[model samples]
Target: MTAPLPSLRARVTPPDAVSPAPTHGHPPLIEVDRLSLYYGAARALHDISFAVPERLVTAFIGPSGCGKSTLLRCFNRMNDLIDNVRLEGTVRIGGEDIYARDIDVIELRKRVGMVFQRSNPFPKTIFDNIAYALRLQGLRRKSEIADIVEQSLHQAALWEEVKDRLHASALGLSGGQQQRLCIARAIAIKPDILLMDEPASALDPLATAKIEDLILDLKQQFTIVIVTHNMQQAARISDATAFFYLGELIEHDATSKIFTNPARKQTEDYVTGRFG
Candidate 1:
């Protein structure tokens, strides 16, 4: 018989340990230098700056519409899809300017994956949902596609739950399982950075806890940037936390410091439940 699979809890890295950077002394995996965004006449983000180290979880926290989601989309240029949406400054991945004239948007998105607030699985079989990207890339061998599908599901911490029902429609899964399927689909492309916008906000307590555990495990292999409303979740899961308000980044520091004793009053007040 095959060896028993490891438990999801066992795959998770301890909260206190830091995953190594993808490369040594090089620039961060993602760099947002003085970045700003606008929708027609209104500005959404202003002079936002931060560097996301590889294999680490960086959480963005703020009140609703503080531009946390907007900034998260900027990493992969999702804003480009909106008409008259203007972007200023630079967002670099692996030291390459993503906004440069020569960049390919399709390939860029493949390199920087995103998971939205709500889980969106395709109207297809669970296996196809995970294999879609690879199929689009012209992968024809059935065995190869199957291997990657299983591997991606394993990486997203969903293998055991779905392995027996790969032929079932993706919509048949629970909310939490659907979200994990989305994560599996995103990682199937082997992205270098994963952007999550309130990934756990819609789930129940138990489901949310499972996602938090999955995020911690995922960071061992992928750089994660999440926008969350839960201060305790941020403190528990993120290695670094950035606090934003009124279109400005108030503070960016280690998660512990930001939670216990922030350098800025706004951060302190926000974390201490005084104000959002």
Candidate 2:
């Protein structure tokens, strides 16, 4: 592996790379305006409008099939791959409408990374898995790929455990390590936004804690949006939380307010375990 740099992030990222939460001058980095989605004839998301600030964790919490994951897919147009999926709202990232006809989805996805509910590493060596996307993006220099792989693993907090066996098969790792590896792979390109869907639901408590810590650290570099069924997990790692039910966004607010003093009765009930 290449020797560690003093500050790889400083060289690759600007101090104020992403816009802050809506304020006097700083606009939210991501804006979803009156968004609705459909899976064939069935509507999945109602008119959902919200803003995601930069460098913070915004988590989506809801019962199963309540459109949490569906809405997340809308961020990078991942829903487009599903047959008969249609969207009718503008999701703008960094002031550009992602649904615009002139947009390049391939490049858009490069700017927006994703981590699924399950850890899905390609059947490749650990080093190769992290380097795969970089190589596809035309990073042909071996030294550059090695350096980035090390940096990404370090950022994901997996380097200390896996540095000795960079060539090991990803499948040979434990469940938690695999998830962190997936996270490492996603961050290798340093996307402006990161979307996750129940990334730790399958893991044990200790592993989940590591993933949560990783998410909190990653928010400093990427605008993170996560969908989770674990309400406590959402409260612990997210700066803000959005509650969903039957395809409708009930309420969104700061984590503390959402849990303790939500504006809506439904939100209160859901958080209080009164109903699904």
Candidate 3:
């Protein structure tokens, strides 16, 4: 099934993942170069250029409909799923152009995982939900799959909460737990990057704080790119912040500078709550 996929050992600890990734570099792990996107004839993203360092959090913030989510969708080519979507320029992950004719979209998705604004867990038992992908990939060894499930939940900071009820339906979980389960499911396959689209917007304050803490811890292993309307959330967890307005990338810089000493007036004004 699925061509036997990669062995659990190989997928669990990829070579590059084990290597220490420098936090600074020229050709960053994710590079968006002069990129633009269009829905039919309506342009959604302007020429957006940025580089995301490995194992760090980069936040995209702006007023609603400013194209933050649209741009985030580009990282994994999720936009291609929509009808009549046209993209210009390129998005490269690990130096390979994902839009290339020979690239495999399925394989790309395995490397770049996504978490949506709302958590959507499968109706199956929690254990089955995490193991579904493994089984589909021909991983028949229960011990191996169980190990990965436990590890993923631990990484998502969910092991302690749901470990005893692994056989229960995932629907029985709280919204926050469901969200963490979604995150655990995404990370179960060992994606190099995790793309989050307002992952904590719907959670309560305490739940949101847990999620924020989880994001901070997760950045040590996975490159994270998040789209958030809550500027405070961005400021709390992101290493860098990009400001988008009217489909344009107004500024992208260190979170500290973006908040305290932004180079762009537009960024300054937006961050200060003058206008979004």
| Candidate 1 TM-score, true structure as reference | 0.89
Tens-digit lDDT track for model 2 on 1-276?
112223312332111212123222434778887788888899999777778877888999999999999999888889889999888878899999999999999999999999999999999999999999899788999999999999999999999999999999999999999999999999999899999989999999999999999998998788899999999999999988888888877667678878987666677778989888
**Candidate 1 lDDT by residue in tens digits, 27-82:** 46887777878999898887776778778899999999899999999988888888
Looking at candidate 2, the ten consecutive residues that score lowest on lDDT are 11-20
Candidate 3 wrongly placed segments (more than 4 Å): 1-27
Task: Give model 3's TM-score versus the native structure.
Answer: 0.90
On TM-score, the leading prediction is: 2
lDDT of candidate 1 at residue 238, scale 0 to 100: 93
Residue 161 deviation, candidate 3, in Å?
1.3
